[model samples]
Every structure is written in C-alpha cells, then in structure tokens.
Target: MDPVRNPYSPGAGRQPAALVGRDAPRSSWRVALERIERGRSSQPFVLYGLRGVGKTVLLSNFRRAAAERGWITAQVEAGAGKSLRESLGETLHAPLADLARPSAGRRLLIALRTALSFKASYDANGIWNFGLEAASAPGGGADTGVLETDLRKLVHDLAAAAEEEGVGLAILIDEAQDLAEEELVAICAIAHAAAQDEWRVLFAFAGLPSLPRVLAEAKSYAERFLYERIEELHGDAASEALTDPAASENVRWEPSAVKLIVEESAGYPYFLQQFGQDTWNAALEAAITYDDARVGAAAGRATLDNGFFRARWDRATPSEKNYLRAMADDGDAGSSSGTIAARLGRKPASFGPLRANLIAKGLVYAPEHGIVAFTVPGMAGFIARQPSTD
Candidate 1:
C-alpha cells in the first residue's frame, strides 16, 4: 500500500478521516448553535473524559459546526501557568475586531485597542517588558487589573458586539482541567451574566474527569451543563473506524485482521489510528492480513512508547519516576495510594504532597477516596515496559 494514500491521522488532536460514534453529540451541538442564532438560550456543553478519548477532536468538530452556522468561534488550549485572561483576550481580538460594531463603534474601539495593547508588553520568548507603562487600562477591556471582574466585562462586551452583528460567539476551550478553580468560576460568572442580559454567547470546554467538580463549585447553575462523557467507541463503531477508511482508499481489510486490530486497540480512537496507520504501511497484499496487524501492533508499541510515553517520562524527576513505577507495579487501571506507598517503602500519609503534585500535572487523578488512576489511557502499560533504572 502507498503511504501517500494512508487516510488515518495519528497525531495529537488531529482529526481522523472518519469521526465515529460521536454523531449524537455532534447533532445536539448543531441544534444548540442554531438556537443561539435565533436568540434562544441553550445549555452550554462541557466535555469530560480521560486522555485520548477525543475531547479535543470533538471540540474541533463542534467549532466547525458553529462556523457552518456563520457564528464567530475561538478555540484555545489551556496550559500550565498560562493566564486564561491573557489567552481569551488574545483569541477574542480578531472575532470582536471583525464584528460590525457600527452602533457602538467608539466604545468598542477604545476597549479592543486597550486589550491588544497588553499583548505587546510580552514578547515571543515570554520575556516581560520591564519599566513599561501604559497610559490607562481601558475601562471595558477584558484584561482589566482584576481577573474575575474584568473577564465579565470583556465577555459582556464581546457578546454585545456579536449580537449587534447578528451572529453568536462560540468559545471552545481545550484542557479546561488545567484552569484553577477561581478561573472556572470566573467563566461561570461570564456565562451567568450573558444569559441574564440575553446576549449571544455560547461556550464549550473539554477537559479531564475532574472538570465537573470544579465547575460545579464555581456556580450552582453549572449543574445544568450539558455534560458529555466520552468513552471507548462501541464495537460496531470501532469496526467501522477501522474498515471504512481503508475501503474508501480502495483497500479492503480482512475480517480476521480487523478483529485483531480492534481487540488490540481496546476501541481507543487514538490507538485505532495508530494501529491503522502502522498496519497500512506494513501490508503488501491488496487486503490487510492478520500478520500485518501483528506487525502494526509491534510497531505501534515503539511509536507510542517513544513518542507519547517518553514525553511525560522525560518530564519526571527521579522520585516521580520511581513513584510512577511503584504505581505501575501495583496497578491495573488504578491502585490504592497505600499500595503504591508500600511499593515505594514509605507511609501513605507522607506521600500526600507528591500525590497532589501529580494530580496538578495532569499525570494522575483521584477517581475516588484513596485510589488514583492515570489521566492518559494505556499509560500504565507504557510505564510497565519502561526500564527500571530509577
């Protein structure tokens, strides 16, 4: 098979050739977009799942749906130590700038000019410009001196601009779990105010399982969020993910080969693409063979280990590596902290700060009392295969 014709995409956050088993949510979101256009309220969505369950991809798909409805949209990935105020300010610039604000032209111009001015104070390398002072912070700028208060004003202004332009604004945020509790509440405030004023704003965020609790704490209204929990694809959908793309390229996959690939992947979308790409490159016959799947599985192990797992591994200190190894030794999908502590030859109580740090890093999460699980799917197996040098 020619590699050029390989339709599967295996990169991080890359959209697959065929998005499978997500039709329900996609259709629901399309309806929500339409409702916003008609000045009707819709429950906003927050997508939650473990790593590799396609939250980012689904967010991307939803953004495209909003675009089709002629709505203004912005998608951003939240990162550690990054200010949501700064990110939203920067991302909202273009859409708000492009908005037809003729009625309120003077007021919006003053606000946006002040907002973009703040971005210039920081350089490409993140070096701050010391000894630089601005004449004034725009009264309506999102980057107000305070995060919460200013964010509300900023959001209100953008929604006003969008409503004036006869369009709705959609903000899709990825890695919402990275946001601090205070930041989440600030966003909830923005949403609450938007609804109260009947402004045209739609928000969707994708994050790990921990997102709901923080969001709920932010506002009681968050309880009504359209929570979509992404999980492994159904068996039929998983099979279609494997077979349909190949068939479109005029290549067929044997039943035996498809069965082998699906079984090995455990219906994970990213792993499916990993297997599909490697298997296609390994195949020689017109039809994919079971042997090709075996080879692909072998190839995928190294690809996942070196590319995916190693990135996290490289970031771990010696103690963190040993801590992870201990968890891997005691684990299936998850294990009790006490068990991991025993494996590390320490008392569980003493590991409290370390456990908290891991949670903050998005490496592991507490599913319930006393137990922790990897944020990423298949992470335990990858950790088990690592050399135990630490």
Candidate 2:
C-alpha cells in the first residue's frame, strides 16, 4: 500500500525548489537578475516577512535563475559570528578558480592569499585544499576593511574571465539580517563598489522583517533602491493557489474546504499549507467528498488533530499557549495588560514571561506599543475554537 502524501509542508524551507504560491515574486526577481546581467544595476532586493512566509524559497529561486543566466552564483546562510567574507569568498571561489585561467589563476591565487593574509592559516597551498580549517580562515589575504575592494576585484576579474569563457557573475546571500555588524558593513561597501565599477555582482537576500533595517543600518544608500516584499496571498491569488494545482492533479478540493483554508489562513502561506494538509487528510479519513461538513467532522477526529495543528501546538509553551487563548477570547477590543492580568488572575507582571515567550515563539507580535497580537491572521480564530481550560 502506498503511504498517504503529506500535503502540510510545515517544513517549507527544507524544500526550496518545490515552493508554491510564489510565481509572481519569482518572475519579478528574474527580471531584476536580467537587468543585472545586462550591466544595469539591479535593485538590491530584500524579501522580508514574518516566519514561514516563503522568503527563503523565493530567494533560492532567484539564485537558481542567476545561474541559468550564465552568471557565477554563490549562496551562504548568515548567522551571528559567522564570517560573511569567508562564506562569500568560499562560494565565489569555485567559479573564480575556474575563471582564474592560465597565468591569471596564479595571480588570483596570490591576490586571494594576500587579501586573506590576516588569517595566516589561509596559505597559497591551503586555498585549494578542501577541509574545515581552510573554510574558516578569513578569505584571501585582503584586509577585512578592503573586503569591498577585494570582492569587487574578484567579481570584475571573474566576469572578465567568464566573458572570455562566454559566461558572467552573480551572488546570492540568504539570511542577510543575521550577518555580523562589520561583515554587513563590508557587504554594503561591496555593493556600492559593484555599482561604481558597474561590476557584475548580483545579490538577492531574504530574511525576517529586520533584514531591511539591517541593510539600511549598514548603509543608508540601500534605501534609494526598491525592495519587493513577498506578502501573503489574497483574493484571486489565494483561490488559484487552492484550486489550480489540485485541479491539475485531478483532485477536487471542496469549495468549503478552500474557503475554510482562506479564512483560517487569512492568506498566510504557512497556514495555507497547514490547512491544505488538514483538508487532504479530512478527505482521506471519511471516504467521503471533502465538503464543509466532512472537514468539520474531521476536525474533532484524533487523526487530523494529531496532524499539522498538534505538531505546532505541542511546540508551544503552556504560558504561550495560555497567552494565545487569552488573545483569542479578548477579540478585536484587545486586552489591556491590566485586563489580561485580571483575567489570568495573576500579578500584572506575571504575564510578562508568557508575552515574551509567545513573541519569541513567533506566534505573536506587537502591532503597536504594549499591544501584542497573533502573528498569523487565523490564529485567533483557531484558538477561539479550542476548549478554554482557565
């Protein structure tokens, strides 16, 4: 017997290529990359949104498109304390090495080593060696301050080399928000240098809402450019996401199920995937058409309960869970911290732990000062539907 397909892609980031509901954004990105390849400055793009908004997948698509355009592409996921220069340099090296060519390879090698000299371990012989140690060292003998210069030269030389070989150069950076402070400044410097020299360095970045802030904090010039935000779907796009793919696969989604998803997801991509997964399971368990009644019936069934919702549900702390339910009950007239304190029957500051915990879980955010709300639109509704223990 074949196993049932898991439609709920809670792990959206793990499958970048099979992303759904992002065609418009992908097309826009392709256009941006095309401009960069033609020696025009592509807008430095930042795909910002809350967690599970498909920002990561969209950025990966941009990277893939850059490669197809004969551009040398490299990708690195940024994190605190990680050397963005070394990561960028490592990814850029393969194509750069390929481009290094007869005598240029030797010169580039010397230059790379010199640029990276601060890290004494990155010797000439050690550059090409594959191991954890080489990858960790500062890239090439270039001073970190002149990372902009070294990277600009790397791209220019690589483009020249690629042009000779009938190719071009592109760079993809993910999680741009997590970059170390100095590394981020260096990256902006490189972007400015690329623009000044008209070098063929193309970058596509995706991260949490803070990413644009980080870029601007690094260099205000980033503000002069336009960055596209990949928002949740609505209206026709949501309908298409629900119906088009299912219809093509010869599977029919009950109109009610689709509507339920739209209402529950509030058009958020992650919730869309979650609702879709749930509806599919609902259809399977009943051996009946997946209509509103069947889905409603399935809601109480343990099979569906133990599915996507429970997975996310189980991950939340008791206090965070309590906080969510409190929000749901408070309705549109949001609860005051004092009101919440009274209802929860605890010290005013006692809710502090739960509030901060919920925010950290990414389940809620402060839309205004002292006013926190669920990060997902349908979250309140779902919480409302659950049994209230307190």
Candidate 3:
C-alpha cells in the first residue's frame, strides 16, 4: 500500500474523503437554499458539538454548496483576534467585488454603497473600490458605530441585492461560542428580523455544545432556531465512513480489521481517519488485516497524544492542569463543579476563575448548570496518562 494513496484526512476542519452520516443536515441546507431562492424564509441552522466532531467540516460544506448556487456567501470564524465587524467586513469584500459591475442593478449598487459604509465602520483608513458610482447610490447609513443598527442595514440591503439577482445571501459563523455577548445578541436580532421580514438571507452557526445555550441567552428568539447536535457516527454509517474511502483507492479492509479500527476509534470521524491512514500505511497486503489495525491504532493514538491532546494540555497553567486532573476522574461525561473543587481541597467559589479560564481557552464547556465537561472527546483519558507532579 502506498502512503501517498491514503484517502483519509485527519486535521482540524479538514474535509474527509467520504463524509458520512450527515445527510439530514446537508439535505436541510439544500432545501433552505432552494426555499430562499423561491422567496421563502428558512430557520437559521445552529450546529453544536464537541471538538473534532466535524462541525467546521459541515459548515464548510454548507459554504461550498451556497457558493455553487451563486449566492453571496461569507464564512468567518470568531475569536480569531478580530472583531465580528472586522471579520465580516473583510470576508464579504471579495464576493461583493465579484458582483460589482457598471450595469449592476440599482439595488446591487445600493448594497455596494451600504457595504462601503460597513467597511468604513471598522476601518476608517481603508476603503473598497467596486468600479461603479456607488458613492451616489441611495444606500449608505451602515456606519453608525452601533453593531445591531449597522449590521442590520448591511444585511438587509445585501439580501435585497441578492433577491434582485434571483439568488440569496448566506452568512456563516464558526466557533460562534467565542463571539462577544453583544456581538452574539446583535446577530440573533438581525437573523430574527430577516426571518420575520422574509429577507432572502440564510444564517448558519457552528461551535461547541454550549452554543445553543449561548444563543438562547443572547436572544430569546434563538430558541426557535434549528439546532442540530453533531455527534460521532454510529452503526453502519460509521463502518461506511472507514470503508468507502479505502474502496476508492482499490483497497479492501478485512471485516476483523474494520471492526477493530471502528471500535477503537469509537466512531469519531477524526479518530477514524487517523487510524485509517495509519492502517493503510501499516498494511503490506492489498487487504488490511486485524494485526495491521492493532499496529495502526496504536500509532494513531500516539500521534494524537503527542499532537492533538498534548497541545491543549500544554496550554493550561499548572493550577489549571490540577483542576483538569480533578475533573478527569469523571472521564468524558463531565464533572460537577462542586466535586472538582472538593477534590482540589478548595471551595467551589474560589475555583471560579480557574473554571472560567479553561472555558475561555476552549478546553472545557458548561454542558449544564454547574457541570463542566471537556470540549474535546477522550480528553480525560489523555489527561490521565500525563505524569503526576502533585
């Protein structure tokens, strides 16, 4: 087997060779696009899940699908050292530029002017030239220095322009749980308005499992948004995810080998791909066998431990690592805040900053009131394997 022919991809947000078990969400997004193209509104999609569950991959798929349909699509990630206003302004520029022309529709011209204002709102020294007389267009009030007011004006005008072109607008945000509270509230408000007014725009957000709760807290209307919880593949879907890619390379996996990798990876897409790649490299024959799977799984685990899990583990301070160690006793199911504090011989109130810091670093999340869990799967086991210094 040639390592160069390996079809598996294992990295953050990397698209898999065979994306399986996501038909429901993908179909729903297609329907949403069609509905918007037909002057109908669709509920925003909120995808929440643990890290490495393929939320980013699915969101990227939605972006590609919308772009294929000629929609005005801008996909951005929050918490990347840029404000929402700045990130959205920068991402929307290229698409908006593509739509600019001398014979552009009146509404499109207006949208271009509005976009200029939005860009100016964040970057006073920078500007965009759409090669049209947009300065004289009838739209340009989006630079009001208010998030809700400015974003609403920009999106509304853009949606109108999209409708004029017989398409739609799409705005997708990943790592949404990292957005500022005010920014999240503003987005929810604008999305609510778009739905009520039947604007030709669609929104999708992806983040940690706490994303839905975060949205609800931002705006009550977010309660009605369509929330899809992405999890590991199961049953036959999981098997197909591993087999389909290998089949494409004209390789076969013995039933015992497939079962070994599937069970060991626990159906996680990232883990499956890692093990699949390793197994492909380990197999000397055209058919992967159980022995090869054992070696590959071990190699894959070592790779994850050194790179994936260790990276996050090293980001924690010693005090935070102690806190994480206390939580590891509960495995991946999460730990009670009170119990973690009791284990650390400290009051729960005193450990609030530690818990908050972990959450801020994206290593953990509060799944429910007073219960925090690792945002990454199998984190507890990784933590447990570390040498103890306390």
Give the per-residue lDDT digits (tens) of candidate 1, residues 285-385. 77999999999888987787888777877777788778888888655478899999988789999999988888877888887779988887888788878
TM-score of each: 0.88, 0.69, 0.99
Ranking by lDDT: 3, 1, 2
On TM-score, the leading prediction is 3
Worst 10 residues of 2 by lDDT: 129-138
**Residue 209 lDDT (model 3):** 96
Which parts of model 3 have CA positions greater than 4 angstroms off? Answer: none
How do the residues 125-173 of candidate 2 rate in per-residue lDDT, one tens digit apiece?
A: 5435321233332335354455555555555555544444444466667
Report the C-alpha lDDT of model 3 over 1-390, residue by residue, as the tens digit: 799988999999999999999999999999999999998899899999999989999999999999999999999999999999999999999999999998999999999999999999989999799988887779989999999999999999999999999999999999999999989999999999999999999999999999999999999999999999999999988888889999988889999999999999899999999999998899998898999999999999999999989999999999999999999999999999999989989899999888899999999999998999999999999999989973
Error of 1 at 206 (Å): 0.7
How many clashes does each candidate structure show, in the order listed? 0, 10, 0
Superposed Cα RMSD, model 3: 0.9
Count steric clashes of candidate 1. Answer: 0
lDDT of 1 at 359: 86
